[model samples]
Target chain A: MKPVFTRPRSLADVSTHYCPGCTHGIVHRLIAEAIDELDIAERTIGVAPVGCAVLAYNYFNVDFQEAAHGRAPAVATGIKRALPDRVVFTYQGDGDLASIGTAEIVHAANRGEAITVIYVNNAIYGMTGGQMAPTTLAGQKTTTSPFGRDVEVCGYPIRMAELLATLVAPRYIARVAVNSPAHIQQAKRAIKRAFEVQVNDHGFALVEVLSTCPTNWGLPPKKALAWLEENMIPYYPLGEFKVPKEAE
Target chain B: MAKGKVVINEDRCKGCELCTTVCPHKILALDPKKINKLGYHPVTLTDPEECIGCALCARMCPDCVIEVYRE
Candidate 1:
């Protein structure tokens, strides 16, 4: 017998601190698998965000830099510029990228930095006790928005992938989900392609992954996956928003 | 049926029951009798012979707790 599936080499053997059924772990595995498949673990440098995945550096066996809340893009830009030969990527949550670090991410994508970004959007803020986030869907109940997010007052959720895709400088921009096995496989492919864009020196690449926050969402693990598919997918449709002409 | 088996790292599982939902054979279930160090019921295969090694459960596991082998 031969092992058909096992943990990727890029991922550390230790268990992650994520809650039960949190999709962050799935996304983490996908990124690690991408790094392994590309054979870039030795030269990969990950910028960890200041959200629930703050301890991301401990999980991935690679050189990592801790970025200030929402400053992962800025830190990644510096690293990629300083170490041109190294593969640079940032793992950021919606609260980190879409809220506080909005300016940093926008400018980084606008500048066309040769780095990959794995953006996890689980709608509500997970680490800070389920507060409403800029990406939180309308009418979605959260700690801050107990009455549910009102589009009229709180405004509609920001679609980061679409926002980044509008930028002319990005080499690739995609959105994927990890709610199911099929989606996980597609998400893995998109993550790998995002890395490929940087490896090929194709300016900036970002893959926004629609993840689940079972703890914050007040739902069981399985229901969270279904909620994400039924609610998040309709608003933030999954697909590659932009791709370099040659790669398309 | 394709001969295959899965090894669950009990300590790494958080009792999410995600693997059970995706298992085609419905062979995966949380071991009610045993709890891991994390205080969650660990997953176990009920009938090893039923596993086809499609790796759906392994793929769905967020913690990478399951390893699939095929013969």
Candidate 2:
């Protein structure tokens, strides 16, 4: 017998803290697999941000730096600058990146920092008790938006990938979902390409992953993925918004 | 048809039931009779031979406890 799906070496041998069917774990696996496949696990440095995935440092088998909420791009920038030989990446959620870390990420990409970012956009703030986040749907319900998100007051959900794509320094920017097997496969490819952009020293790269939050969404794991496909995917379409010419 | 089976790392499993939802053959289910050290019902294969080794369960597992093998 042969095993096709084994744990990636880049992933540590421990359980994660993400909620069931949260899709964070799936994103973690994809990142870990990318690191292992690129054979750069030892030289990789990961910046963990403040959010549901704040403890990501405990899961990846690499040197990790904890960044302030929304400051992961800044932290990763310093790390990549000090050690240009090492591959540096940041794992951040929507609340940490799209909202608070907006300035940091914008500057980092604007400067073309040689780093990679794995952005998990679950729409709502998962750790802070499901508040309406910048990426939250127009009419999505959350603890802060029990009446559902009012676009008139809250404005439309910000599309960070598209926003970042507008910058010239970004070498690669893609948005993908892990709701189904086919999409998950595409996400892995996008994630791998983002890391490759950094490894090749092309420029800054980011992969925005559309994740699920079953506990916060008040939906079962299966239904959460379905809801994401029906409600979230329309607002945040999945595809590569930017690509490095070398990669093409 | 391919022959396949799963290996569950009980202690690593949080019994999230995410993996069970992705299995097309419906061979996976939480163990009601046994509990892991974490006091959670770990997922187990009900009919090992029914596994088509899709690996979707492994993909959806947050705990990374499930390993898929096929022959």
**Candidate number of the best lDDT:** 1
lDDT of 1 by residue, A31-84 (tens): 999999999999999999999999999999999999999999999999988899
Residue B68, model 2: lDDT of 83
In order, the B-chain TM-scores come to 0.95, 0.91
Per-residue alpha-carbon lDDT of candidate 2 for residues A1-248, written as tens digits (9 for 90 to 100)? 79978999999988787776678998999999999999999899999999899899999999999999999999998998899999999999999999998999999999999999999999999998999999999889999999999999999999999999999889999999988888889999999999999888658999999999999999988799899999989989999999988657
lDDT at position A60, candidate 1: 98
Candidate 1 docking DockQ: 0.90
- Kindly report the root-mean-square deviation of model 2 from the true structure over all alpha carbons: 1.4
The C-alpha lDDT values of all candidates are: 0.95, 0.90
- In model 2, how large is the Cα lDDT of residue A162? 97
Q: Could you tell me how far off, in angstroms, the CA of residue A123 lies in candidate 1 after the best superposition?
A: 0.2
Docking class of 2: medium
In model 2, what is the error at residue A15, expressed in angstroms?
A: 1.3
